[model samples]
Target chain A: MSDAERLFESLARAIIDADETAAVQLSETILAKGFDSAKAIERGISVGMEKVGDFFEKSEYFIPDLLDCAAVAERATAILRKGLAKEPVSRGKIVMGTIFGDTHDIGKNIVALFMEAAGYKVLDLGKDVSARRFIDAAVQWKADVLAISTLMTTTRGNIQNVIEQLRLDGKRESFLILIGGRAVTREFAQTIGADGYAENAAETIRLLDKF
Target chain B: MTDISPKERLDRALLGKPTDRAPVVCPGGMMNAAIVDVMNKTGHTLPEAHHDADKMSDLAFDVYENTGFENFGIPFCMTVEAEALGSAVDFGSLECEPKIQKEIFPSVHDAVYLPIGAIEKTLRAGSVIQAIHMLSAKHLDVPVIGSLTGPISAAASLIDPMTFLKQLRREKETSHKVIDYVVNQLISYAKLMADNGAAVISIADPTATGEILGPKFFDEYAVCYLNKITDAIHEIGVPVIIHICGDVRMVKPQLQKLHGDVLSVDAFVELKQLKTELGEMRTMGNLSTYLLEFGKADEIFNQAKHLTTKGIDVLAPACGLSTSTPSENIAAFTTAVKEG
Candidate 1:
């Protein structure tokens, strides 16, 4: 096998095992050997993350497994990004956050990681995000998708508020708004006029891909 | 049947014995029904009710009086146990439920193990106990449910949850220690509630789910720790209700082994199928809160009737109720169970 193919295999294997040390080592090896960073990210890290996503969807990997894989991919991607000649071509820019009054963000965080691994530039606004902040970030970032999440039933309404504010601000058509979480339903998504709703991290990427 | 008190009805239903009908309720903690309409109608608002025992009792009673829920569920939100364990909690407004602002520790290894009985001394725990006492005294016939955050969830609340979840595999030893400590504290807390006049204790562990922990950790940590609390509550002669949030399809076998008398599941799990699979196990819930919040009253009533026909022991919300959920919809839900 060629050197680049071997390094890609090793990098992907590191992510699947969720081994940060091996991921970092292989990332450094890729840079030192002067392989294309974009190809390394696409073939090595993204393929590994997609596999991780598959494991999660199959219930073979749970939240902890996904989080660990995300951590590994995150560290490896950081090293690979340093070797990029210019900004890599973006699939799209996405803004994500847990809606206001909700502190839970694990689901949102996982979705953000998956989107980034799939080559979307994600601006994660973090948890307890207000409608104003969500609108502001999406407008400033010129994001294609605004992904909102909330775990609590009480806070899910904040998602509707975000959608309403977008309309008032004349930016409702600018971004395709998506909502998901324990509290959000596909019916709720449609009722609130959201563009899309996904049930899990993998489905979130699939939905965004179709758009 | 007409003479059956709420407590008697619930106790009988929980035992899988013949009851006048299914006991309809919203077990507190995560499934609390202290909605805005009830609070606003009574002028006993939250953020205040969450801390003041009298207001808490009054609001819980008002929820029962107005919403058609048959029991009084104290300490509306799930943050009581987390706050008692040193996590910074944001006591949200009348409209928003409380949420954990920051965990006390960053990692399981860094967790400061408080004494087993330390939770009893916390003010929030005191308020809950006091509220249970007040409700028990004021409404002798109605059951006052004491809600607890289960061990895995309480531990996750103490340590940064992201770090805690990852450590379930990475740092098994410390994870066990932290959750064990949290479980011990929960046992004492449950006992305190029992002693304080909580007729039934409900433990809602949203973090301990088949989807999140999978079967292995769900067995090792979630089931183990939850059974510890359940056994302790059982030893106190109090009935236990265990709510496992999210999907349980992966851990259904392990879940069958839980000592909790009533198994409350999320909205998606078909309670009828669950009842058939886990025979003679009194199942509590599977009603969609989304329907209660957004759907029509007649539809909610139809769904409630569907659950009743399936012979669910305890009729309740599948999970937490939205603060903005209409009282009329909740009324329709409970009415169907009552008419059965």
Candidate 2:
């Protein structure tokens, strides 16, 4: 294989192996070799993360494995970010958070990881996020999609309140609102006026890809 | 059948012995049914009930009497174990369940191993034990199930959950030590409950599911520690109920290895199929809480009938009831199993 091809392959392997040290070393090597960092990320880390997502979809990779992959990809991305241009291209901007009154975020974290892996810029607002914060973050980030996750049935109504707040703020039309979590269902998503509902992280990426 | 009491009915059903019909119950902790509708009707509410034994007993009785559930389950939320273990907890208002505000340790390596019985000395544990005693004494015909936050979840609650899950792979030694310590504490707490008149000890470990831990870790940690607690509970003379939240398709083999008298799972699992797979196992639950929260009474009743006809040994909510869930829907659920 050509040298650049070999380097990109190594970067992807580092991510798939969830070897943060190896991924950071490979990204450093890429930068030292004056390779295109954004191309390296799009070609290498993203591909490995896509594989991780697929493994998760097949139940071959559980939460810990997915989390490791996300951690490796994050570290490698941090190294590569320095080499990219001032304005590197992204797939889209997505704002994500666990809805108000629900502190569970593992599902949301995985969703954010998959979205970022798919090349979207994700602003994670963390857990127990309020409707106002969600709307403000989406508007401030100029997001293409607003993703809300919740785990408890008690907190399910808060997702509706988020959508309602967006409408009241006159910003409902600006971004697509997506909802998912253990408690959320496709039928409930429809009932709550959510634009889309995903069963898992992979489905969320596929939905975002379509739009 | 004529002399059957709710406690005897539940005990028999849990032991896989025959009864007039399935005994519907809400195993507190995560599956609590002290919903707003019930509290409103009875005028006994949470956030206040959580800390006072008398109030807690009254509220649990209110849930049992109003919702047609057969038992009194106490300490309404899962945060009790976490709180007693040194985690910062936010005891939420009436409409919201308490949640861990901050884990005491950021990772298992950083965890401070408290003395085994430290949890028993906590105010929340005291309240729960006192409440269980009061309920079991006052409502002699009803069983009082003491719900415990299982070992894996209790360990996760002490450390940041994300960090803890990752550390289960990265820091196996410290993870085991911390979890073993937590299990010992849980045993003490369970013993305290059993001594104070708790008829059944239910363990709900929401974090230890196959989907989260995979088969390998689920077997290594979840099953191992759960069996440790279950054996202790059994030695103390109360039947143990083990509730592992989420789909168990990945961990069916490991799940079969659990020693609890009754195995409770989430709504998505097929309890009938599970019973067939694990011969002679007593399966307790599989009702969708979402339906109880959102569906019409007839729909809830029909689903309850479906589960009943499937021959599940014990009838209960698939998972935690939403605090906002309408009483009529929960009534429909319990009514279906009771009437059948």
**Could you tell me how far off, in angstroms, the CA of residue B194 lies in candidate 1 after the best superposition?**
0.4
Which tens-of-lDDT digit does each residue in A1-211 have in candidate 2? 7787788888888888888888988999999999988888888888888888888889888888888888889888888889987657788999999988899998898889888877899999999999999999998889999999998777789999999999999989999999999878999999989999998888898899898
lDDT of 2 by residue, B224-318 (tens): 99999999999978999999998899899998889998999989899989988776569989789889888999999998998899989999999
Q: Over 4 Å off in model 1, which ranges? A: A85-89, A151-164, A182-196, A207-211
Give residue A106's lDDT in candidate 2 (0 to 100). 81
How does residue B319 of candidate 2 score in lDDT? 87
TM-score of 2: 0.95
How large an RMSD does model 1 have?
Answer: 2.3
Error of 2 at A180 (Å): 1.9
Error of 2 at A80 (Å): 2.7
TM-score of chain B of each: 0.98, 0.98
Question: Model 2 scores what on Cα lDDT?
Answer: 0.89
